[model samples]
Target: MAESTTIEYLCKFCRAVVEVFGPQYLRSPNAEDTTRILAQNEAREFYGMLGSIDCLHWAWKNCPFAWQGMYKGAKGGCSVCSNVFAKLVEGHAPPVNFKVNGRQYNKGYYLADGIYPRWSTFVKTISNPVPGGKNSYFAKCQEACRKDVEQAFGVLKSLFAVVRQGPLAAVDHQVPVAWAAFLNMRQEIRDPQVHQELQKDLVEHLWRLKGNA
Candidate 1:
């Protein structure tokens, strides 16, 4: 149950990480996320849901040997952006394929914390949520659904027990040259309009789905 770099092999890593994913691991169905059914089953409000993102700091399981020098942080390499989830913001992750509360959303969102940028793809819980209103009810449902992410990570750590795994995380590194792409990515993540709309839609959707229950 120990995760290490010295253990260089295929079958072990495959069985641990690959087989766990199968074909659905790399190639999602029709350019959409793979966790829609599971997430929706967990909560109807998560109709077009991806998976939850948390703030649990994880060691970078695999950092490029050359970049390790610049990637040191309190938690190993801080939190590196996973390609699987990074695709969400990169404009290639998913298409506008699902409808929630009558509105269409292209990107399936992850449940993140307030530390993350306000992007449509990341949803965070309300702080000091006033109880008994939509805010309170939405907060309750969001928190409940987020528990699955915690348990999922627990299983991942148990299986590969080395570097902790973050579902979707950001990194702190300073070696960049692509100003064009960087600016664009920054623009998208900082869009308050999109974040506001997504949060509103999610609040309405979750309220309708579980508020009465």
Candidate 2:
């Protein structure tokens, strides 16, 4: 057999490692994980929050002509959500019970921005919040915490540049694994009613936590 080029050999090695350890390490959060996430978020006045959510854009300049449309966003650039984020969305959403203003919520949430849908899992910053009000305070805290999500994305990308740089063939080979593991992308994540309720609770919760201080 002919010897593979450096990039080809590296791709093969990376593929093998991902195949073996991806399921174990790339896996979703569990009960213990949620507990830790909750404690950390609660310290920030966001009870029952798992983390923040946001997507970044990358220019896939060499994207296939036929696939460019799919990759293109409104501004004509490619946007990709982090793989770890996919795991969280498709992963097991444990019942994270918590109370705010005497109201209870069962599922955890992520601090997002206006671009995202108003889903139960996403707690977006209040837009144009009235000055010196609970909404203003809540927006301040939520947006501040949300800033960390992008930094985390940067760190992950730096560590896993291979996954982003692998040749088309290697990426194609691994895409199926992600799809196969997608248990409930839509049903589990989209809950508008719950989102509204959760948002209300959070606004009140944060206001009480810091508004008076």
| Model 2 misplacement above 4 A | 1-3, 55-76, 82-92, 162-189
Question: What's the lDDT for candidate 2?
Answer: 0.69
Positional deviation of residue 51's Cα in model 1 after best superposition, in angstroms: 0.7
Per-model TM values vs. the true structure: 0.62, 0.71
Residues 1-213, model 2: lDDT tens digits: 345687788789878877887655545566777798899878877888777655334447677878876766545566554443444444445558898778877667778778778887788888999999989988888888877766776677688764344322221112323555565555556878878888888888777767477
Off by over 4 Å in 1: 1-43, 55-57, 60-77, 89-91, 162-186, 210-213
RMSD, model 1, all Cα superposed? 7.3
